[model samples]
Target: MTRQKATLIGFSAILLWALLALMTIGSAPVPPFLLNALCFGIGGVIGLVWIGFGAGFGVLRQISWKVYAFGTIGLFGYHALYFTAFRIAPFAETGLIAYLWPLFIVLFSGLLPGERLRALHVIGALVAFVGAGLIVMGRGDAAGAVPVLGLSLAFLCALSWAGYSVLSRRLGDVPTESVVVYCLLTAALSVPAHLLWEVTVWPQGGWGWLSVVGLGLGPVGLAFFTWDIGMKKGDIQLLGVASYAAPLLSTLALIAAGLAEAKPILLLAALMITGGAALAARASLKP
Candidate 1:
């Protein structure tokens, strides 16, 4: 695909991720690892059905086991660390730290072989980060003593995702189809982890099950595929800067669902994130 088209596809992942919190709430009482297992399993099944209808399972065999390993580690490790961090730290603090991935992605994209990192990209990333931080911190949770280990894990969670995204550029030749393997392997891994750490609790009802399906179809499933395409062929820096919009959009989704209250700060965050994305887009447009 053309760079512009790929970037737009990647941006779709961010849009889909905006429903993550709301969907997770709807799927509630299901523990994190079990939820991961369910969503990734559903995502994997979707991929399998997709492949069966079009390219067939032959395409999967062509991908290297190394690629599968990398993708699985990226998907599973990120969720594992994120869940662990929140379990140990205050939700607001852990979440704010975890949201640093976008900033990290923007910074790290400069190191990619053909990419140029302009000043505006950094400034834009920082501006967007501030907006995301406002949303995370505005959750009104009381702050307690800092949990160093949890904070460290949260930082690593950011790093893990940023590294995965940027490194995927180097593997540009890999088919997005390989993400199917990644999802399946991640689900497999989550199954054992859930058995070890969490009690199994299925979705409570039709709404709960629908929420799980929604997550698999959108945020957890298709998002990775589109993001891979974007990282491999799209404007990575622009996508990185634009990723900050996920949190803002997610909060809005929550408010619309009546899971969260609409706040004045969200309006300010909207402006800041918009301006930051505009700056990044301008930078990318420079000849």
Candidate 2:
């Protein structure tokens, strides 16, 4: 696909990701780990159906366990932390914090072979960090203040995903079908965690079921595939800038769900973060 098409696809994935925070809001009928298990389980099935059993199994057999380990830690680890963060903190706050991956991506991307770390990249990373600091510290009202643990985990989610994106690029020739393995591994990991730590209550009703299904089919499942394709084929700088839009979209989703109110600080944070990320990626943003 052309870079433009790839970018559009990636942006669409961002929208689905925005919806994730809204979908998995309350806890009881489905705990964090259990939600993850269900989402990844259904996602894995979707992947399996898409690739068919024979071809999918062939790819799996060819890949090393090392690959699976990395994929699991990246994909599953990010989601687990993310879901838990939602449970502890306001979804909008946690999401903005987790959305730091775009900035981290710009920083980490320089580590790859043939990619040089530029001065603007450093300056921009610092600027973005400052923006994140503002977000973390800018809770002028007690109603929206995020807990320390939730804040920390959200940042960890960013770090985990940034590492994942860079590593994914480094791992040459891994097929898009690799998501199937990641989803399956995540499900396997999540099952034990859910059984041990969480009470296994199924989604309460149609709304709950819809959330699980939407997560699986949209963000957890198809979004991964589209993102992989975009990262491989799209304009890097463009995608970097585009990624910042996720926090805004996610925050908007929260507002629409009546789960959050629009805060001026969030807009300022968005500007700072997006501008900083854009600065970091300026070298590649050229047409």
Please provide TM-scores, in order, for all candidate models, with all chains considered together.
0.83, 0.90
- lDDT by residue (138-194, candidate 1, tens digit) is 655533345778878877987899999999998999988999999999999999899
lDDT of each: 0.78, 0.80
* Model 2 agreement with the true structure over 179-275: per-residue lDDT tens digits: 7889998998999999999888888778888888888888888888788766766655577777877777877778887888777887677677778
Over 4 Å off, model 2? 1-8, 26-29, 53-56, 141-145
- Cα lDDT of model 1 overall? 0.78
Residue pair clashes in candidate 2: none
Q: Which candidate is the best by lDDT?
A: 2
